[model samples]
Target chain A: METDLFEQTILPHLDAAYNLARWLAGNEHDARDIVQEAALRAFKFFGGFRGGDARAWLLAIVRNTAFTKMRAQPAQDLGPDDLDKIEDTAPQPAQVLERAGNIEAMRAAIAKLPVEFREVIVFREMENFSYKEIAELVNAPIGTVMSRLARARAQLREIILADANLRETRS
Target chain B: MNCEEVRELVHAYADGELDVARSVDFERHIANCESCAAALRNVRALKPAIRGSYYAAPDDLRASVLRFPSSPDGVRQSGGLPAAERRAGSWLLTGLAIAAALILGFFVGDAFLRRSANQNLLAEITDAHVRSLAANHLADVASSDQHTVRPWFEGKIDFAPPVEDLATAGFPLVGGRLEYLRGRPVAALVYQRRKHFVNLFIWPGDHVTEIRDEKPQRGYNIVHWANDGMTYFAVSEISAPELRQFARDFTTALSH
Candidate 1:
């Protein structure tokens, strides 16, 4: 009976769990391991699921698992140079549109965003998660989710446009 | 709403997250202001583009998960021995018992392994197709024009995904999105047959070949194949024969 419940509640969300883990862990191997660990944790704590959005609940566990894994490892040496670069560019509307259809450019831009901003974009734009749901999942208030999503999109646009300009000159 | 207020609410307005009254006000402002309207369109366009780019879980991930003991306590229920006896057994005996179980499982489970792998792939893609529809995110780049939708995948994936308009053959091109299948990025082409939506996931295959199979799961018909260094999986709620026809037409179009 408990096995049936676990299968019904958690197994269906395996893609979502893997997706969140991939984004947070920054690669496939770590993401896979993290997802396995997260699933085990979810199974152990299945009683606490509380009849809500299973995808969001499982994703929260995946997010927490990824965070714990990251904390245990030393941070990458890529410094604040990217953040500094983002502040340097004054966003222009024409630039954003110019880079709009370039999916590769956009993916790279989003990948470079800070984790806080990146997760909001992944949850909102990619996953179609609502603001309130995002707040609850990420343990932030609604207002913070809104602002972070806004900031993430704006920064992503600027970065894509900047990359477009760089390519144009090189060509 | 003034430009400042409109700017603040633009994202919310584009997301359709605003309340009705606020939405009405937002629309009123957008209708009157060209710049704000353009900004809203950009916001709308950017979202689908982002949704088009995502990672799919590995193929075996689901099967491995399915094989995991259902409940946490199931791990303790190993070998049908009483909890006390199992814990009190000598460590060497426990190790030998585990090794024996592992060897037995390997030989006995080997026969079903191939079928399970196929089932897991079918389940994964079907679930992806269903989730795309359920989430109302079936197409990140929603355009009937193959020119517009096909180029949308450029740089998003490592290969150029074949996108064709099969409207002439009774299957119309809907749009496409980037999906991960079996651990790598693939392109998902959304097509429509009557009122039914078809999700065709394509990625680069190892060799040039043609193989087709029609499998039904939970009322959805899935037809998948690999051809000319590209793999395709077409899934929909339409009849299996209709989906097969769609696949044939798609393959013919790609060959040109």
Candidate 2:
């Protein structure tokens, strides 16, 4: 009965689980390994799962599993004061419009972000998670999620502009 | 609200996470403030561009997940064990599961290459469509406006692939990319049909033909035609009739 429920409730979120794992682990091989391990762990702890957001529950497991693997090589979190150092000048709307289609650059920028900022961006922008949900995922207050999102976008804009300028210089 | 407050609230506003009253206040400020409004637009644009990077679980991973260790007997056999013993057994079980998934992946990986080697035109087109969606590679020049998307192909492809916004007909022009098909570079125009994407591949060719019978390849609907010396293939996951409508409307739009 539990196994059936697990399949029905948690299995549908495989794509979401893989996406989070992929972004966190920063590679496909590790992502696959992490997700597989996470899925087995989730199954083992199936008895503890009360009926709630299965995607969130599964994703929380995925995140923990990825972090455990990353414990060996810790990722530095961005400080709140880092925003001051990151120039507040956002990419102009026109420049953003022109570069918006360059998904490669955007991907690179997101990948380069610190894991703390990167996760919030992924949750809010890609997964369309609410601030509350993002806070719950990261175990932070809603204010922290909002501020991290701001910093992430600020850094992303600068990184994309620098990349574009570098390309222009090269070509 | 002051500019500082608006700047702070813009990300929340863009994410639709702000409360109604705060959102209203933010909108009111942006109504009169150009910089604030531009900030809002820039924030909004970031969403879709980031969403484009979403990685769908690979087929093999998905297949392995379906076989995840949740079998009833497996659970029952281990269900009555002591707490410490169960913990040890679970680790053993987890090890077995990983081994099983790895073995499955190897076979699935083999089948994947074999499938790729024998892929036909329709198969290749469907793969390209899937690949575009896989890794934030949907478009080299993403835009909804035909004027913007059309000119982007200049000096890139040899010939102009007729670009038109089908938004009026429910299929909006999403963007364009330079795709290599038939061993040469071709123009791939992407359009949005509801949630699904329609990839229209175009290249210079002398083969003259009308819209052929819809061929469903690897679960994606394929519609192709030759017009005015250009070969076109429209591929999407939308229904056959809907894809036909897209082709007819697209062809009609190009003629004008």
Tell me, by lDDT, which candidate is best: 2
The residue pairs found clashing in candidate 2 are none
Q: Under CAPRI classification, how is model 2 graded?
A: acceptable
Stretches of model 2 off by over 4 angstroms after superposition:
A72-77, A81-97, B70-256
lDDT of 2 by residue, A33-151 (tens): 88887887787788899998777899999998888877733346455532343325344745555565456677788899888887888777666568999899999898877778888
- In order of appearance, the predictions have TM-scores of 0.64, 0.61
Model 1 residue A152 distance off true place after TM-score fit, in angstroms? 1.3
Evaluated at residue A16, the lDDT of candidate 1 is 77
Put down candidate 1 lDDT per residue, A25-132, tens digits, no spaces.
778888887877777668668888889777788898888888887773324442332212221222346766656655666777888888888788888866667999
How do the residues B58-160 of candidate 1 rate in per-residue lDDT, one tens digit apiece? Answer: 8798776655442233233223233553353443454455445545555555545555656867987998899888657787788999999988887667689
Q: Residue A1: error of model 2 in Å?
A: 3.1
Candidate 2 structure quality by residue, lDDT tens digits, B126-148: 87798788634688778998899
